[model samples]
Target: MVLVAVLVVVVVVVLFAVVDLGPPHATTNKAAIPNRLR
Candidate 1:
């Protein structure tokens, strides 16, 4: 049971990270994201 819980948590975290790092092509301010991140 514990292992199953850990797997689910890891999967969710990975998905979140991927989505966060992906480019937001829908917006016109594509260059602004990296500047804000720095």
Candidate 2:
């Protein structure tokens, strides 16, 4: 029972870390936009 509890905690910690490293939103993108109008 103790081992299972530890395993669950470890998994939860890893998932939290993964969420922190997820892809950023549009505002976070630094690339400049191209204008199509001539």
Candidate 3:
């Protein structure tokens, strides 16, 4: 059915979004924000 197809697509998109593409504890450089951004 059309409804079933749409549901499958939605579920696939949600699963893809939840997939992690990197290590959980990875760190990155932090940059200081300008005064205007605070």
User: Which candidate leads the pack in TM-score?
Assistant: 1
Q: Per-residue CA lDDT of candidate 1, range 1-36, in tens?
A: 999999999999877655765654546345655765
lDDT of model 1, residue 23: 56
Estimate every model's Cα lDDT from 0 to 1: 0.70, 0.58, 0.50
TM-score of each: 0.57, 0.54, 0.51
Better of 2 and 3 by lDDT: 2
Residue pairs that clash (backbone atoms under 3 angstroms), model 2: none
Name model 3 segments beyond 4 Å from true.
Answer: 21-38
> Could you tell me the lDDT of residue 20 within candidate 3?
34
lDDT of 3: 0.50
Candidates sorted by lDDT, best first: 1, 2, 3
Show model 1 residue runs off by greater than 4 Å: 23-38
Compare the candidates by lDDT and give the number of the best one.
Answer: 1
Clashes of each: 0, 0, 0
- What lDDT score is found at residue 28 in candidate 2? 36
Per-residue lDDT of candidate 3, residues 1-38 (tens digit):
99999999999975653453222332321222232235
Q: How far does residue 34 in candidate 3 sit from its true spot (Å)? A: 22
